[model samples]
Every structure is written in C-alpha cells, then in structure tokens.
Target: MKIKEIQDEIVEEFSHFEDWKEKYEYLIELGNSIELIDKQNKIDSNLIKGCQSKLWLYAELQNDKIIYTADSEAIITKGIAAILLRVFSNQTAKDILNSDIKYIEAIGLKEHLSPTRANGLVSMIRQIKYYALALNTN
Candidate 1:
C-alpha cells in the first residue's frame, strides 16, 4: 500500500483504543509482529544513536524498494520501529524520503512517550531517511 494509506490505516487502528494502556499493549503487539532481523545484522553499525535503548536498523535495496529490519532492547522502541518500518519498508527510496508520517502526531504517540523515547523516535525516522537518501542515488 501507499505510505499515506498505511498511515491512515494505523490512525484508524489506534483510534479504536481509548487509553494509553491499551495503546501500549497494541504497540507491544506490533513489536512482536515485526519481522525478525537476522542476528548477524544486529551489529554496532546498525545501531541508531540517541535512543535511550539499544536499537538497531538495517536497510537494503531490493528490486528498487527499500527493506528495513530493526530490533530494540526495549519493547516500546521496537514497536515504534515496527510502526515506522511498516510504513517505510518495501517502498521506493524517493517515496520513503518524500512521505510525511503524520500518523505519529495524529495518534498522539509523540506526546505520550517519555522524552527520551520521543527523541529516539525522531532519530529512528532520521536514520531511515538517511538510508533512503544514500540508497536512492545508486
């Protein structure tokens, strides 16, 4: 699906929950459902900086689409990354770079997160974009 379409779907999904606790449980579920990254790919180079928890992101270009795989020591972080990968993965580099992920704000996730996790989220997004930028040119 297109990025906006996927994001809108997420917004709809989050709207079903009335409270943060339920939302958090949903996040855990998303994290658990994330496609597992290879153990070898979880290396120091893939680790995203600025996150309070250890988070690793690996990306590769496959058939002109970027595939993202991530893991985090913290469940919430992993879940957040899963959300991001769900939106950005299997997409063209330009599409990933140009897409605006407004669902984060629309779902009120950023405000509810701890400041550190919020920063981690930003870092994760930035790193994903950086990967797209680097790979898009090739």
Candidate 2:
C-alpha cells in the first residue's frame, strides 16, 4: 500500500478504541507482536540518542525501497517504531520523504504520550527521514 493508505488504515484502527487507556493497550499489543531486530544490527550506531529508553533504528535500501528494522527497551517505543515501519518500510525513498505522517495527530497519539516519549517519537522520525534522504535515488 502507499504510505498514506497505510497511515489511514492505522487511523481507522485507532478510531475503534474508546479511550486512551484502550489505545495504549493496543499499542502494547502491537509492541508484543513484532519481531525485533537482529542482534548484529543492534549496534550503537543504530541507537536513537534522545529517548529515555533505548531505541535502535536501522534502514537499508532494497530494490529502491528503504527497509527498516528496530527494537526498543520500552514497549511503547517499540510499538511506535512498528507503526512507523509499517507505513514507511518497503516504500520508495521518495515516498518516505514525501509522507508527512499526520496520522500521528489524527489518532491523538501525540497528546496522549508523555513529553519524553513524544521527543523519542520525533527522534525516531528524524532518523527514518535521514535514512530516506541518504538513500534517495530520484
């Protein structure tokens, strides 16, 4: 799917929950469901610096798409990474760079997160965009 389509799907999924508590529970479920990055990829170079908990993000270009893999010491952060990957992974570098990811706000995620977690989210996005910028071919 296109990035916008995936993001819209996420927004629709989150809309089913009645409250933030339910939303958080769903995020935790998402966190638990994902397979983590390979141990070899969990190097210091991949670690996101601003998060209170450790989050490692890695991206590589494959067939003109940027594939992402990540893990986090915190489940919520992991869930956030999973969501990002779902939207951006296997997409063209240009598509990743062009998508604004407004579903974050549409889903009411930013307001619900603690300040530190919000910063971590921003850092994660920056790192992904950095990868896209570096790998862009068009």
Candidate 3:
C-alpha cells in the first residue's frame, strides 16, 4: 500500500482505542508480533545510532526489497521500532526513499511521545532509511 493509505489505515484502526494508554498497549502487542532476529545477527554494532535506549536494527536485501528486524531495551521504544518496521519492511529501496515518514507524527504516535522519545523515533527511521540507501546503491 502507499504510505498515505497505510497511514490512514493505521489511524482508522487506532481510532477505536479511547486513549493513548490503550494505543500504547496495542503497540506493545504489535511489537511482540514481530519475528525475532537470530542471535548472530543481533550484535550491538547493528544498534541504531542516537537512541537513548539500546536498539538493535538488522536489515537485509531480499528479492530487491528491504527486510528489517529490531529490538529495543525499552518496551515503548520497541513498539515504536516495530511500528516503523511494519511500515517499511518488505518495501523496495525506491519505495522507501520515496515515502514520507512524517505521517508518523500526524498519526498521533509522535505527539504522545516525549521530546527524547520523538528524537529516538526519528533516529530509528533515519537508520532504517540509511540501510535502504545502502542496499539501493549496491
């Protein structure tokens, strides 16, 4: 789906939840659903840069698309990471680069986050897009 379509769907899905607390709980549940990466691929060197919490993000090129897996020391951060992964994973490098992630703020995730958390989320998105660029270049 296009990013805008995906954003709309997420907004519609979360609209049913009454508050940010429940939305966060739902996000945590979504995080738990992401497949865990292998221990060998989960090295500290793969950790996202600029995040206050330790966050490991691993990406690979498959069928000319990027597949990402991530884990975070903080639950809420993990959920945020998962949300990003769900949005960009399995997409072509061109698609990812062309997409506008700013919709995340419009979707209410960033608004509820603290300044530090919002920065961390931005860092994670940058890291993922960097990986996509590397894949595209190679």
Candidate 4:
C-alpha cells in the first residue's frame, strides 16, 4: 500500500478505541508485533539520541525502497517506531521524504503522550527523514 493508505488505515484503527487508555493498549499490541531487528544492527550508530528510552532504528535501500528495522527499550516507544515503519518501510526514499505523517496528529497521539515521549517521537521522525534524504541523494 502507499504511505497515505497505510496511514489512513492506522487512523481508522485508532478511531475504534473509545479512550486514550484503549489507544495506548492498542499501541502496545502494535509494538509487540514489531519484528525484532538483528542483534548486529542494534548498535550505538542506530540509536536515536533524544529519546528517554533507547530506540534503535536502521534503514537500508533495497530495490529502490527503504527497508526499516527497529527495536526499543520502552514498549510505547517501540510501538511508535513500529507504526512509523509500517508506513515508511518498503517505500521509495522520495515517498518517505515527502510524507508529512499527519496521521500522528489525526490519531490524537501527540496530545496523549508525555512531553518527553513527544520529543522522542519528533526525534524519531527527523531521523527517519534524514535516512530518506541520505538514501535519495546516493
């Protein structure tokens, strides 16, 4: 699916929950389903710096698409990473770079997160976009 389509699907999924508590539970479930990254890839180079918890993210270009693999020390952070990967992974660098990820606000995620987690989310997005920019230029 296109990035927008995947994001829309996520929005629809989140809309089913009646409250933030339910939404957080769903995020945990999403995090639990994230495919584990290889141990070798979970090194310092991949770690996202601004996050309170350790979040390791890696991206590689395969067949003109950016493939992402990630893991996190925190469950909520992991879930956030998984959601981002679901939308950005296996997509062209151009697509990833152009994506605004508006679904984050649409799903009411930013308002629900603690300030630190929100910063982490912003850092994660910047890192993902950086990866896309680097890959697109190479």
At residue 82, candidate 4 shows an lDDT of: 88
Candidate 2 residue-wise lDDT, 37-129, digit = tens: 889999998899888888898888889999888999889888888888889889999988888978988888875345465438888888899
* Model 2: residues with Cα > 4 Å off, grouped in runs: 112-119
Residue 73 deviation, candidate 1, in Å?
0.7
Q: TM-scores of the models, in the given order?
A: 0.93, 0.93, 0.87, 0.92
lDDT of each: 0.88, 0.86, 0.77, 0.86
Summarize candidate 3's per-residue lDDT along 106-135 as a digit string, tens digits: 667765345565437777778888998999
Q: Count of backbone clashes for each model?
A: 0, 0, 0, 0
Over the stretch 1-138, how does candidate 1's per-residue lDDT look in tens digits?
999999999999999998999999999999999976789999999888888789899999899999999999988888898999999999999999889967999887866344454437888888999999999954
Q: What is the lDDT of residue 118 in candidate 1?
A: 47
Q: Write the per-residue lDDT of candidate 4 for residues 1-138, one digit (tens) a residue.
A: 999999999999999999989999989998999867789999998888888788889988899998988899999988888889999999999988888978988898865345565437777788889999999944
Which candidate number maximizes lDDT? 1
- TM-score computed on alpha carbons, candidate 3: 0.87
Cα error, residue 82 of model 1, in Å, equals 0.7
Candidate 1: the clashing residue pairs are none
Deviation from native of the Cα of residue 72 in model 2, angstroms: 0.4
